[model samples]
Target chain A: MATNIAKIACAVAFAAGVAAPVTAAAKSSTVTAIEERGTLLCSGHNGSYFGFVEVNDKNEWKGLDIDMCRALTTAILGDPDKAQIVPLSWAQRFPALQSGDVDVIIKATGWTMGRDTEVGLQFSLPYFFGGTQFMAHGDLGITEAKELDGGTICVEAGTTIERLAGNYLKTLGIEHTMVSYEKASELRAAYLANRCDAFAAWGPFLAVLRATELEKPDAHIILSDQLSNEPIAAAMRQGDEEFVDMVNWMIAALLIAEEEGVTSANVEEMASNPPNPKIARLLGVDPGMGERLGIRDTWAKEMIAATGNFGEIYDRNLGEGSPYKLERGLNNLWSHGGVLYAPILD
Target chain B: MDAAALKLRRSRRDMLVQTLLVVFVVLVIWVAISTAHTNLTELNMTSGFGFLERATGWSYSFSLIDRSIDDSYSKTLLIGFLNTLFLGLICIVLSTILGFAIGTARDARQLGLNSLATVYIQIFRNLPLILQLVFWYAVLIHMPGPRQAFTMGEVAFLSNRGLMLPGFNVSPTVVLAMFAAVVLLAVVIFRQKSLQPVQKLLLWLVSGSGAMLLLAWIFAPADSSIFSIPAQQGLRFRGGIGVPIELVAMILAITLYGSAYIAEVVRGGLNEVPSGLTEAGKALGLSSRAIWFHVKVPMALRTIMPPLGNQWIFIMKATTLGVAIGFSDLFYIVSTSITQSGQTLELMGLLMLSFLLINYSLAQLVNFMNARLALKGH
Candidate 1:
């Protein structure tokens, strides 16, 4: 008789435990919770993704994605080191965001119509533009993707590149088989071991892989054909327009800083001695932008001082300052031949 | 113990407790549904199985059934499910046979065989399954390409692309003859109650050999060939069974890895069988083979059944790791679909249902075996 009463009590307790979280989540905003926690939880790649997200020799996270997380955290909390990156597989990233396990996803996530409309997440503006391409051993003498006909291509599974490469090969009338791996490192290992004739991935990512991870960079070359556009962006949980606006404006601030010739080293000097009205407003010398976004006036200035302008961040992680040595082709400012442009900092 | 006494002793506390338990369960379920509804509504997404009818624009390299890129998502999932079942069933059969062999070898008196079995168990058992899978896959991938593949006298080929083996396209006559032979064998076996054991055996062998000869006679291309060997055509092998290297690697890793644990179980079962039973069999004037078949095996099997069934279940679960090596098992396909469609919750539900069905069937089968083998009184 007593055991029956105990069972009833246990059931009631379990029910209460299950129902408590819903009420708690309903009461507080996710942004406020992140702010209170002080650390900006970010989802990124588990395996080294070359210039995007990887562990350095010192075991510290160092990459373009990590810098983006730092920039977002600095804009929000006025501190860059408060950013914490949680590495996740490509399949786990969206689920992790939806479950609120991470505050934002600074992984090199591509923005797509299906993803935006179907998945319960919103993407910020495109921070980087890349396209699907192929890389093969230089000894193969294959200059283009069409040359990989009737050959196997190695790709990463559960990624856009897999679909892109598959579709592209179909269009090229090639009867090819794809062996996709779950992890980036495994894909590279299989390709390097000559298991696959070509490796399909984004152009910049392939460049990073070749320049940084390969035994000999000159031994392989990425094909110049751009099969599909991949506008990479940061993702955040939906239903928080404020948080979305905050992240979007943070990315825009970097582009605007590049336009205004603001570097991490020169941000403080530029803020103190404004060369133009737009620069004055951008550095928060004259407030209004951050107030509208429900953040502090010094948000852009803090972000710039921490991670530098878009050009500087690109150069440091994926361009001349890094081993990838990628030029700012399509990623350059709009005034140049490239298409990267920021809205006027009114 | 009487029903009247039980009814008279029913307390109000028991009734209240039962009520509370039901209420709690209902409340928990209610909360879960409402929360999911709220989240889906906020996301502006519809929840249902309507997406199953949509065409899967992607193509899979390997499928157990005939499928194309234009197939529906439901068909894709079914193919993935079948592939997973195929791998699981193959691994289970292979591992069981290998485990029994190794287990018997371990129990044997010879030091060389025993040491070899022990070394195999130790090595496979120590390494992680995923790491082993990746390693095997890497080895296969690094093998020579199609032009320089290792071949078996033009009958079979092994390359980094895959292994190709001679496949059969049985003629109508061969199929009819095989069916007729099976019926004939059944009839002969049924009528064998009046015949001597040697006569029965002779009848079986003649029928089997006749069936084989009939099939062999139909092998030539009078109308169409019964068997055809694979031949290289351009960059691909044509007219043969092409097994992907991914599948080979997955199966090899799962079988070899699962056999290690199953071997240990077999060894433990063998050790648990008392020597006194064998002594008793011998005292009863039973031969050594009779003692082993009657006493040792039955005794060992009674102990081995539960753990062996558990190992089988473990193997099925391990087939999910096939995703690492690009074998399009159910989990891998569902995960890829979720990534493409962004229907995590719905696809996860489907995945859970698939695994649950498989596990439930295995559990039922195991329970039935256990009941059949159970001691009479127990």
Candidate 2:
């Protein structure tokens, strides 16, 4: 009887210990440090890969990640000026975060296992979803990435693109050589020099490169086939649950903005009026919604005013207004049959 | 009556020496580790070595190993270590040669040669090594495409991507012949060492090496057929050696930077040697070159060994600049390893340890050389 009771006790103890993790998992996510600092610290790339991250004539960073930072800043501080963007290369991004150099990283990073389990980071939510693709100079008549058998490729160092490209080549049983350089500039130099048969990179980047950097934009074409589906997100150090939630909700808000008719031009008027109870709540026409997120009722309104609506942001940073000229495909609202779908506002 | 005096006498010397010894030990360790440990852990991160086993599923643009991102971070690090070693060995040999030329030129009487030496040293020394690296990379990477690549006699090729040339693709017959050549060279060197004078032995070695190389070229049989990438196509290249521009830049930086300082050291060492030593040798009917070689430089070697070793540590540390060009040397690979493993502290420690090992080994080598070559009476 004593042994059985002890056994039962041990089982109960094990169950309790296992169940204890629920609170621990929920506890580390406080965005208080970010709120106190009054700025969203974001680390991004230095290059003008175009539409992604680039420095303007004044030498300030501006791009998709920059816009996201603006949106989050407006959400938290009721002012867009509360966001600071720190530039880092592929090698510098993680160390900066691990050392508290930056609050979060929204650089062009793929959500990988090592980054999560090994690095002790929380990848809050994927903002931009895409994959690796290859592009060849049109004159080579290399229609497919597979057609470049025994050809050479140029890629940047500290990226997953090289591995992905190699995997595809291996699958097709084609012989190829991959040359890498430390910076994007070096890779681009090699590409322009005609050292590589193809330049392998992300889809959006290829489009941006063609639009902006090329001497003749139409001289090259990106292969339609994607080698990998990368779900990139804003990342922060583990144990900052509140900050993670804030960034996660910020990404969801972008989808919600698309779902609603809240363009940057029309957001002010819409916030004043009411199409639905949800928009009023989201725009803080109602009082309770903003409090739940630990912000002022005018938080959404300020965010919209600072960076424009989701549609405006996309258009400005990556769409028709920007040089990339990308169409909103799966990134559109669920009602429009794209991948973006945010939950209904409470 | 004498007890107090004795106590005072012992303590003043003992306590001071003890204190000095403790301070030295503590300070050395503190300087070695405190910064890396403190800066890394403050952000809720811990340092340790658990990251070596985790999967790294990425591929490098330039790799010595068949690494995929799927391989362990440890593998990438190993590959990077090998690259650094190859670069270090090459730069050491090249800088030694360049240093000799520069040191010789500095005091030379020939007006044109002196001016050229001065120009070479000024140009290379004035430019930052990293800037030089970037410049070299820029020149190489921005060149026109392969079809438009500069070609020499339809054999050597250069393009922005990388240079491709005819490499010896080795067959089994070539391997056997290489082994035979190695054995023959070894036998020749052994005979020269055992039976001949030093000068005569050196002559024998040069001839032996030349004959072996000639035979290998003839028997190893490089394909005069269509050229391939300078690196081996399937595995590693046997005959065709490709020095990638990234590697070229790093070597250039390390060698050019290191050689300038070495030249200064050599000059200083030579100046310290008594002029009478050479005059004595000449009086004894020894040649001027032989007098300088057999007596002066050997003595100078002892005086300069420690500083040379210190420069080597700097060279090893400066190799971290390879990160800029993506050569994946110790620093570059360590950073990537940190990124993949999330074991930042452990990997950082590992990196420091690796550098410590490299520095320690180089120091040991210099110390050994200094000890063996130290003057007998001193």
Candidate 3:
């Protein structure tokens, strides 16, 4: 009789232990949980991915994606410093967000239909645009990707580029082998060691590597043909419409700030004195914006002040203000001959 | 004093305890699975094995079987399993042979051989397997590329790309038949102790050639050649067997690392053999070589089987480290599958089941071998 009682007690305890987390997760909205926890969790890259996500000499996370994470934290909790960065690999980011280990993935993740539909994740607007391309050793004398037939190409595993490269090469009837590494550093090392004839990755990252990593940048050539043009975005869990809307508008506010010439330096002054109703509404000079989004009206103001507008972030990270010196290309605003256009602020 | 009654009471209690324990386990599993299902439903993610039929748009550096980007996830995973099994089997055979040689060298009279074996064991055993894998990979990739390959008389070529060797262009069925014939013939000859040496030789020669001719007549196509030599193509060797550097490095690292532990096991087993047995063989007018093999090795078998089985299983598990160097073993393929399909629970479950099945088979084989080697009526 005693043993039966003990067994019942153990079974009940085990059931409760398994069921506790599910109930806790279902109880609160992501925003409410962040508010209660007093910290916003955001995903960072596992290693240095130059210009996008990287660590600095001061042991602080500093990159475009890092700034984006901080901006989201500021918008949600009203304090950018409350953002905690959880470094994760490319394959780990989606599961991490789904499991609530991180609130958002701002690690320059590509938006794909399969991921959005099947992976239980939602993506914000395209914050950046890049394409997949191959870079080969100059000694190979390969100028176009088509010339890479019968060559071994290296790629980072668990990335969209791996699929794109594979399909591209196969469609062209090129008989090539592909090797994938788990880490970007390892892939780069393999390429440098000549383990593969070419390396396929994001075009901008290849450019960054050629500029910064190689002893002789001219020793490698980035192929002219591209495998894919991908839209990079911030990803969050699929549920919580309010949280997703907040993130979407937060990005719009940045683009709108850039278009209105409202720098981080002048955001405070502009918020105080309204130049126009649109700017006023965006900076929370008007009252209803934050209330509708379930956040403070001054959320955009705090975020812009913390991380600057979209143009400023891009310039500081990948454009003329940084070592990369990448041209704005399609990332520039629509009025400035680029494709980026923000939804009108009513 | 009612001992049988006490025994009956104890047995009844044992039955009750076991029944209660099983109930508790089932309840725990039900709770855990239901919780996962509820959470998955809440997250709006599908959970099932239906995703295995989807096409995988990825490719790996090497596979024993022909594969393409359009292959199904199941086929790709099977290829991955085959690659792991191939690497594991080769490493097991090579490490056992090398370990036995080194283990015997430790007991050699020559100081140089003994010291060299000791140093080899220490260095490889002390370092982590992962570091050794990376180190060997680095060494392999640093070799000359295909353009400047080290050629061996137009039959084999060694480059950073891999080792390419002459291959037989015969049907697989013919090869399998030939191998089966040889093994069967050897087993038959071993069982027939009454046969003389010349008779055994004649039987082997006649049967081997006869089986080869019969298999070729039945299975070989009209256009097939016996041998295909590797030759330089545009970027790599063509028309031959190509071994990728990742595979070579994996084999090299695992063999060296695994041999160290296995050599120690061998040495321990040999040490456990009583010196009296060796003396008795010597007194019986046996040569030293015969005595060592016939007396020491047989006696050592009982002590060696268990630890050696453990080493084999460890070597099999170590094949997963192939992922670190892009070898596309089962673990790597399943990880890629999870990333692509997002069926983590189902895919990880499959991966665990695969490893369990493979390692369990290896353990069973070892246990069988141990049973055969056990002294009878002990």
Candidate 4:
């Protein structure tokens, strides 16, 4: 009863906070809708997808994709705290975005051709690169994926991993059974219980599960086999070019900052010191681009202070600083032997 | 007011209400269709049933019909429908038997047995079915692998993969002889008025023994084995009947959960029977067993069945929860297809239609049984 009362109180306080900006947001571009409301509505996973999205012990949402929401909110509304994460299932994600229930979705959604063309949503530049990877019990003397011939593979339903595993095994002429669960956590549990011979998921997600969720980390081995590329990106409703452009550039700023050797700790100093013409332009040393994007002169700097550069976000949520300790393999900067690149500020 | 003026006012009011209702219903449908159309167009989505012909591109773990991953979606949905129906029917039968036993036990004179039944109903009824399914699934999956399964002699084995039991491959001659024996026994029993008791007993013993000998003789063939036990081959148990662990867990959880509700229904119906009926049976010189069975049971059944019918429908709906524990039923398969094909509306329509057909058939059966039970003494 106390909890229910507390919940009602919180809801009342939140509604009171939202009332003023909502009337101001009624007639404007979606960007103004976000700015006036002082909140960036983001759709994310209902449960922890490990490093992608999860609510922490402090009752705050945390993860790499969540950091993206923080970045965009800080860039647009100038307040990192002005962001709301709406939990959604895989099937619910697109519908929620289409219904305007959410401003954007940064829930490790794979940018598919079908979704791009058929779904009523627009995707930002790929923020994370992943692929379907297989993990097997270390007790099984299987070193290669081909060794899993005729083995049952556990996977989450309605995911690319299911189709990828099926197609990959079929190409090898290896007949296998696939048991699909609705949630990733359920799939992981089944795998832990020895229900399947191999567990298939995105490489980074599997890494996070093995590193953190497992009691015996070394008991499982993720094979180095890549089944299909899964380029994760953010999605929003179409017909809002200003909102789309703003979202895209927020992603680009992170990459550009990383390229310019600007860390969140050093961004303020870089803005005053004027490291180079490119860095200066990115930091709004000569401010005009902010006006063009309809943001503040120090928008990029504020965004960096709120979250961090792409590398910092990656390291903090998924890499060296996180339990997963995933290396920025294909997600590294373009100049660093990876595919990620930001267009020049010029 | 006079009668003519009052009647005219009443007709006008009735006409106004009828017109308003028709307009309201049409407006609702129009809004619904337009919203769907606008949403689809804005999202750039195509709507049709043509995708059903496309290959499923994934295989299910358990299927009643022979199907490959490359089969059409229609065929996949059919396989899923059959699996759901199979599980639903099995749970209904098992839960009914368990329910009656527990209900009777709850009413038993033995204090210990009554308490035991009470505890079962409390535990299962209070807990949700999904949680029970996951719990049972976890327990099953933690069992030893196929190679090191807990074995029962050479005929049965239990493992994380499934339960394997002995399968019989009887010869045609043995089956025919068994049928002939059944026919002879029926003839002797039906003619009991003409035949002596000794004659009837003698005939039964002869036919039964002849059927047994015939089965033994047929099984003595040196060329083929009649009884096949599952053997561990590679990573799986092969040869005998293999019941997947998921299916077992789903059935166990569903039956246990459903039987609790069924027990309550039965207990309520039985208790509602008048004590006078039992006293009347005693006055008529009926045994206790006969009094309960012939007098009270039939009376309770009329009350028991309607609620039991409701419980049956509940079980049918609960079968969809099998998807949570990786039991591949119709709802699970369609949900998977929706995620893959991005055809949510069409697939959902198909799922609802299939369930509607299934539940309607079940309701019809329940109604038929209820009607028969509603009739009196005959």
Which one wins on lDDT?
A: 3
Per-residue CA lDDT of model 3 for A1-346, tens digit only, reads 9999999999999999889756653322778889999999988777788888888666588778888888888988988899898888989988888888999898878899999999888888888888888888989988888898789999999989999999999998999999999888888888999999999987888878886889987788888666777788889888676677778888898999999988899999999897999889988898867887777888889889988999999998887787666567667898997777787788
In order, the B-chain TM-scores come to 0.85, 0.75, 0.92, 0.81
The regions of model 2 sitting more than 4 angstroms off are A1-129, A150-156, A159-182, A194-197, A230-346, B1-48, B163-239, B281-288
Q: Write the per-residue lDDT of candidate 3 for residues B228-332, one digit (tens) a residue.
A: 678888877886788999999999999999999999999899889998998899999999888878899899989989999999999999999988999999999
lDDT (Cα) of model 3: 0.87
lDDT of each: 0.83, 0.72, 0.87, 0.85
* lDDT (10s digit) by residue, model 1, range B172-268: 4565567688778867775867887678878778877777666756665677665668887655676667898888998899999999988999988
Docking class of 1: acceptable
The sequence of per-residue lDDT tens digits that candidate 2 reaches over residues B105-198 is 7645689877887777788778888888877766766776555657677567665545556644444455456557666766766666445567
**Cα displacement (Å) at residue B139, model 4:** 2.3
After superposition, which runs of candidate 4 have C-alpha atoms over 4 Å from their true positions? A1-130, A230-346, B1-27, B168-228, B283-285, B376-378
- Which has the higher TM-score value, candidate number 1 or candidate number 2? 1
What pairs collide in candidate 3? Answer: none
Colliding pairs, model 1 = none
lDDT of 4 by residue, B85-109 (tens): 9899999999999999899788777
TM-score of each: 0.62, 0.61, 0.69, 0.62
